[model samples]
Target chain A: MSKSAILRSSIAKKYWMALTGLFLCTFLIGHLIGNLQLIFIHGEEGRRAFNEYAYFMQHNIFIKVLSYVTYISILFHAIDGLMLAVQNKKARPQKYAYNNAGANSSTASRQMALLGSIVLIFIVTHMVNFWAKMHFEHIPLHTYEVTLPQQTNPEMVYYTHNHSLIPIQVDKVVVVRDETNLYLENTDLKLGEGYKDLHSVVMAFFGQSKNGFVTNSLALWATILYVISMAVMAFHLWHGFASAFQSLGLRHKRYTPIIAVTGKLFAIVVPFLFAIIPVLIFIGYVK
Target chain B: MASKTININLKIWRQKNANSKGSMETYKLDNVSTDSSFLEMLDQLNEQLVNERKEPIAFDHDCREGICGSCSLFINGEAHGPDRAVTTCQLHMRKFKDGETIYVEPWRAKAFPVIKDLVVDRSSFDRIQQAGGFVSVNTSGNTIDANAIPIGKAAADKAFEAATCIGCGACVASCVNASAMLFVSAKVSQLALLPQGKVEAQQRVLNMVKQMDEEGFGNCTNTGACAVECPKEISLENIARMNREYLKAMVSAE
Candidate 1:
């Protein structure tokens, strides 16, 4: 066997899948931890904290690099999976008249391609609903209530990128349209900064216009889809987490059992927590 | 022990040839002895068919004790019927319930094409073995004693276990992707564990895996179905070992 290539194409392809898959799993943990703040923290403090976190995620250089890595990993994982799925389908050109795949393998394992495609769809729509809005739209900044000079009613607020609301003179404040920084009137002196209220966007996206209960038809449907997407994610992770180690040739009897148990728990806990966020928001359980 | 007989219906696949489309043909088998093997039950059906001047169902079987991997039948959606760690020849009729309908089909994979009813072209396995399943040995009369090379008991036992693979395509048959990783990995592990085979281990793994891909076998999804359905109860550890060997070979290659 005097082959020039050391690694076969299929095995090498599997290496890429395993690497990208494990990277995505790490991304999931980080994402889940950040989102859990939606429930663990409450009220205006929670909103500000979340908004600040989103800002840091967007602006920090290291996080920016990691985000790009995440994007690349997601794309590679999805595309490579699709290719492998097609090849696998072709491997059995003639379909079995009666196949009971669930007899020996897991339903999740057998239906990985189907589950992955669903999760991909969810990811696309999820990014559109959150990431695109945060990146592209001129989101309104966190508002602070202040009464105008010579006015008793407190309605107006100043927009600043400063995550927390600070005491400011509304009369002396000069605001530029679609700008993040607050300026002293008629001067270039900067007063404070503002942050994109991503927390509000996330809260509104989930069916909580003002409360925990689903307020509108769209919010109800969106909330349901969120929960469903999380379920799909759970199923995908069920087989994928442990399977990655196998694909990577990291299988050890002593560690494998622990890894498998950890995978199963991760499958249940992560998605359940993720689903809980939307359900709570939909029902107005938290701000 | 008293032997019991059970009446069961069979939905066996019937294909004229490789080019022709196959379909499930139903047959009513009466009073089949539960102690008889599944192949024996099929033999009874064939004999009856012969008496009725009907064509006998074509199937592959040898060494009905399950050592020879020639016997292949997808019984009731499983590689070797519902039972685990047994080949089709070793499957007893007692496993089936009375009045139950068993669905029997050929091992389905692009690499293992169905030649007739339950006989598939498993020459793919032979071809894979030919690729790199052996160590390069030259007859120059310079061969050393077999026991000269020391081998650990654990390694020896694991190698022996890996060597037990009967070259059955059951692993391919049961896999959702029809992945041959288990079969190929078993061969890779069997030799790579020995000092004699270690010399060319890198080349062996590379060529074997390459040949497996060229044969149109799907990549492993780590579903564990192959190991679950393997007649020899081959461990998934072999596949993992192969992966380790392959990657090491890949990076260390000159």
Candidate 2:
């Protein structure tokens, strides 16, 4: 009898919110660490590292489970948050004639619904830009240009996607159109495959490319939007991180201050690093 | 502080009844004593209105010393006026500038509708209390001695602190969401700590929170506004404790 009542209450919804919120916070850390590989390691190695990480994230069974959990977390967080916001709004049907909300609370804490909704939009656009393309479309394979002393021109070389030592010569295999398959030239028989060049897609996202400059007007706008969204994300986390702890009833007199400080620090540092990634790529500093 | 007086402007909310619409009416009271309590100053305004054959501005006040939880007012956009850690009746005129205008209104919340002017129907709190705010102790002649039950000093002190909540609804009035979480949490915490109340701890928290939700009060977002504006300076820890207790009950349930 009381079990359904517990689930239906505002506090129970917050319990779910706090649990999912904390889970997502951990996800942010993992995501940021993987993304930092973009700027931390330079040249082909960095590209290989990021692409390898992406491949591992996609192919690993454990990560696949975690990815599903992530998707569920995002959906549940957004929907539950929306429901709470609507309910909370209805709690005060009549607006005060004069309210000095600033005198008592933070602007970020008060505007969480707005900030979260914006972050939701950014997440949608962000998934469409990167996740959709990577998961659904046929992206180019990673191709390396290898030069030999006997050849005046550098030959096109393709490495196996499994990080194997074998390299395929350009003339030895026929490249399929808009696909990653490598076929024997003038024959129906197939050679192996090449790695999906997610590295190139990410690099070119901000106009810089492996080959040269590509004039993508969206690059500047995307960088700006990403940085702004990261800032909004930071603001969201500023109130949210420790608030999750409080909501979960983990607050202790000895540890709450530390948690509060760590929450603020986490809020600022993680987003700053994430924001810096695209900025560095756009400005050619990390390219 | 000798015989101080100051002239000030007032914008007080006035409503004929619950069905009638309210409006802020302006009044200028000259030579008001700075030594007067905020309620006393309002009494002065009421006296002036009576002399002019106008209806006296309706407001709520009782026990004028700030513990009855009756004198609820939002002054200058603050619950219980601008001064911290004090109720409206405890607020004095010396805190205000001589010529500055003061805004006065009732406690604002969906559960706490304005009765007339500064009086809000805080009976929602009473209803929540009625739900499960009490311990089911047999009051027969063979009641146990107070010292028979051993309680840790920490638990006793903490329970005392939670018990200090006067249910003024300042927490709701000052909260951006108008949540009554602090008030409910205090009630839950006070009883939940004592051994006598521990018999019904799970059900008490469950029923109280259920009634609290039924009251249409908003959810607590942990802004600390309620604790800041509370006349008793209730800690946010009580709300957290209530959350813990409520979760424990639910998880341990069949």
Candidate 3:
């Protein structure tokens, strides 16, 4: 083993970022698929089924090993990114006086570390709320169904618009309801069930506030943080995923474009889907 | 082209030796031709300096044609001057305006220690290349027929493009990572693409990349700056190829 880091080149650092990032992307897909199960069936049956799904994932030996790999991948990705960034900083040693070079790249891509750190914070909070609860937190596995049936209502209010032919509704509201109406029988109240009751557990956090107004306010703030973090994540993955593949040296001209498009699709579509889950739950659209 | 003359200020770096303190010494030049190549302008300044009994400003040069890549200068804020896809020797004085101040400096890298004023010891690149940038082939020259081998057009073009890397230190100078990934990848890909080189590709890439790391050059951050400043426009794709090769080597070694 090369004991000294003096010989480490930027090329090696790129490989480090690429390999670890690609691994994380794979992990994200698996995570998204697992989370999507929450949207499948509903009521007590849905919760039980979801819990069973979560239980199998958490307990399976193969998955356990994969989970360890995933953990290492995250740590490696973060550390390697820092290393590459530091090396790059040293490489240029000087700064340009005037930089008007923005053409194709985005601010988000240029500021990857900032975006990643923000997402990291969100990940920690997310794990504490959901992942930790599903794993370490010993919560009751009694499945609770949260529901928000589609609802739209128009309330008459005067618009302050200076006369226009188009009539704009001044106010619109969608009502949602949460009810713990369903239960599972003969199923062991286990860790996975804790995940299915995810909606109530999250609401329970907001519900902890002594004042109803404070609870609603806290829930709104939580939703905002979730949305902002997910958006940042979307941007980070947008540049990172395809860039990682290129860095890892998987550049068949044809497949390169394909991978680029697929990476973008994943970054945009998956995060949008995740964003929806929070919106739906916060608005009481899903119970 | 008309032989128009222009007077300009130059902030050229001067250092007697590596241990000596370096500073930018300014010089004024007049009657410079519009069509005069940048190196010719340097020659005029050196002639004037000799007449004035001052040591002629030291710089590096070889074939004035851009191919040899012996000439390198950080003109103003740009590497190899403002002209795109060309080295400093090939950059014409026409690119500059009359009375403009030009800042020139040697390629700065810890790996590329300055040998004198404008020339650095680039043998580090040679060392990197020597660290297995070639296929382990004995020069029998009788092993393979050109017609017998086949490669896809895209792969062949990419390979040729990569091979065009003139081993200039421009990529190192321009990269914020001081990454020679572009250079290393070019060498790795050139061999990895052909059947003749396939036999030793694994060991070749592994050794080259290892040596590259050992050279104290920074990592490739994929900023695309190296590609931008490369006289040949060598793509970041070369880095990608090296990555694939390294990964393959790792798995095969297993």
Instruction: Pick the TM-score winner.
Output: 2
Query: lDDT per prediction?
Result: 0.87, 0.87, 0.71
Q: Over the stretch B56-77, how does candidate 2's per-residue lDDT look in tens digits?
A: 9888888999889888999999
Clashing pairs in 2: none
lDDT string for model 2 (A1-287, tens) is: 36576567878988988999999999999999999998999998888778878878888999999999999999999998988888889888777778887888888999888899999999999899889988998777664332334553345554455566455565654555325655656755445455676777888897677744254678999999999999999999999999999998888999999999999999999999999999999999887
For model 2, what is the error of residue A99's alpha carbon versus the real structure, in angstroms, after optimal superposition? 1.5
C-alpha displacement of B125 in model 2, angstroms? 0.3
lDDT of 3 by residue, A1-287 (tens): 23232125445566667777888888888887876655555555655666667777888999999999988888777776776666656655534332322322356556677777787778788888778987776555443333323353233323232453333232321111213222222322111123434434644443322212234456767777888888999989888888887877778778989988998998999788877665665775554
Name the weakest run of 10 consecutive residues (lDDT summed) in model 2 chain A: A144-153
Estimated TM-score per prediction? 0.92, 0.92, 0.72
Clashes of each: 12, 0, 11
lDDT tens digits by residue: candidate 1, A1-287:
33434233788778888899889989999999999989899988898889889999999999999999999999988998999999999999987888887888999988888999999999998898889989998777874432255553244444453576544455555554335775556766566567888888888887655423224468778888889988988999999999888877999979999999999999999899888888898888976
Candidate 3 residue B67 C-alpha distance from true site, Å: 0.9
